[model samples]
Target: MNFWYVPWFILPYLLLAFILVKQHKKSNRSNLFFKFIYWSFFYLFIYLGITEIQDKSYFFTIPVLFFVLFSWMYHREKARVLNGFLLNLFIASFGIYLLYNFLITQDVLVFALIFLVGVFVVLVGLFGFVGLMILFYWNALVVIKRESHSLANLLTLILAVVMTIWLIYDSFIAKMLPDWASILLSILPMMFFYFVFAFLNFLSASLLYQFNQPSYDQDFIIVLGAGLVQGTKVSPLLANRIHKAIDFYYQQRKYTRHWVKFIMSGGQGPDEKTAEAIAMKDYALQQGIPEDDILIETNSTTTLENMQYSKEIIDRADIKAPKVIFSSNNYHIFRAGIFARMAQLKAEGIGAKTAFYYLPNAFLREFIAIIAMKRKLHFTIISLLASVLLLLSIIAHFVS
Candidate 1:
């Protein structure tokens, strides 16, 4: 059936346009791009729901409601988290579509769409997480190459935009041209874009890992607690960091005759009877670390507070001024450093290994935290640049 036959689509678009006009007249919000995406999705959902109502096709509405549900539930002030929720919702919608297709008719078109969606979803999801590693490597590359990160980021943005547009165009051409070759058209472009960024990130991370191996020993080593499991026992995630610190302690013992103290730093969470720091200390003792060498800092719940309050405890103990090593997980090291640097603690940021599949959820969480910081200026800059680039690209396309 032709999509134009659905009057619901037409009505929703008209209503969406009116809403945009009203918002534009009433508010100082100049985010036309964001408004466009928001209204587009809003209307598309209404269109789908209305069509499903008229046709009595209840299955199609399930995915639409699911998307709305998850998006609202995960809604935060962070762009990355917002992006992630939307991305995941799209994947969920596509999966639902596949189920609908299988139930209705087992056709090649639906099968192809499913495969194409899978490719794009994998591409986008993998790169979104790996982008952090890219940023890290990009930092090192810029330092050595004496290049500006802003320029590099701009170029990357341009390339991603171009590749996505090309992929869309190529998919249309592939669908139009032939029967057997259409799937190849959809899959190849997405896979290519995904692998291109994936390999770049992998190489960059390798370089970062190689360069970032210069380790140091300090009088005080702070294991920043990853909040407790059920706010009681040390989480396996937090335990990994503690174990790393223990290994470092044993290594120090083997190399030098100096005594080092471990500081388990975190505060009481709402659900916990005791502070996270105390739990970490107990875990350390259970793991065979001597009790005397373990210091518990129970006043910090955040990373910044972890460093700040831990520093005070060390200062009061008259243990040398602020040279410390901090252990968290691998993906967390960069942001942890930002906090450590903010606290002006002389610190080494070390990360324990984490499982691959769980990285997306964790990284999405971190991205949300980062975006909540000084966000207005960052959003303004991003919006301005996106607008300019979009206008330029459109103008170039029209002229050509």
Candidate 2:
């Protein structure tokens, strides 16, 4: 048999391999996710090209390329959980496409009924209907456990309920509503899709930062402050961060001869009698860290300020290109890294453990903050998607 397609198929892979090698060597975290996307598409196109030459019928195997790419990415970076979810979504879409085409080819009536049922089932599963229910119940428990009903605490549950409704309406009632209403509803799904992918990218990037271990030769460790207990003592959340920093400091000392300064960063809230930095610093002193090794940044009211003020202290001390590590709860590590990048500080992150019940809410809060920070890009993309959906709806309405 002739092998005319072999070089064409192999050439792209060779090019992708070269690019991946260069990216790996450059190793910039900012562009790493996009690099992964490029790599995924490279493999996908190769599979499609090979299948096309072999036989058109073999095209059903195209979805397998996505799974293969996901497996490779996961093996390389397990923290890219969102990337796994995204690849799985593509695989699911391919399966749905095959099923729809097969049913339509076999019988139109059967296709309509089966397609409706299948879409409902898949949408329900993808939208996490059952997971949302469980989250709602869990949020209730968390509210009671924490004895606070802050809106932030309820955001995840509220989102789950809203999404469930949106999915149901889009699946079952979109065509039944008035044209304007249908168009608006149609736009919502487009926006939802955009937001889900964007949020996943942010979360994946954040988790990637958390998974990156810092070098042991760091010159500074910045412990970002959470709220204190009655403003006088470190809360469990804050204590965990400080403890992680102390552990890092000791580890650096044990392995390297350089002295690492601990920067306790936080500001005083109105309810607190003392600044968060002072409380963290005191806690560190009690943990037996030397007084000379602890630096206090008492003016930072936010994560960005923590990095900024800590960098100032580092600069003031005349430390040249100080390798730094910032510590926070695991859920907050990614956002801290983002702040560090914004502050133009070269620092890695270390995450302390958090309570199981608190993680979902905390993660949601972080996701919202990330979105806010990139609101311009997100808003523009979302607006464009909504416009496209609305335009398509108008054309379909007129055609019908």
Number of the top candidate by TM-score? Answer: 2
lDDT of 2: 0.73
Q: Which stretches of candidate 1 lie over 4 Å from their true place?
A: 1-170, 173-216, 320-322, 371-374, 389-400
- Cα lDDT tens digits, model 2, 49-73, are 4444444345444565665666566
lDDT of 1 by residue, 109-222 (tens): 445567887799788888873464455445344433532344323444344455556656765665575433443343445444443543343333322321232133468888
Provide TM-scores for the models.
0.49, 0.69
Each model's backbone clash number? 0, 0
Kindly report which residue pairs in candidate 2 clash with one another. none
Q: How accurate locally is residue 123 in candidate 1, as Cα lDDT from 0 to 100?
A: 84
Off by over 4 Å in 2: 1-128, 178-181
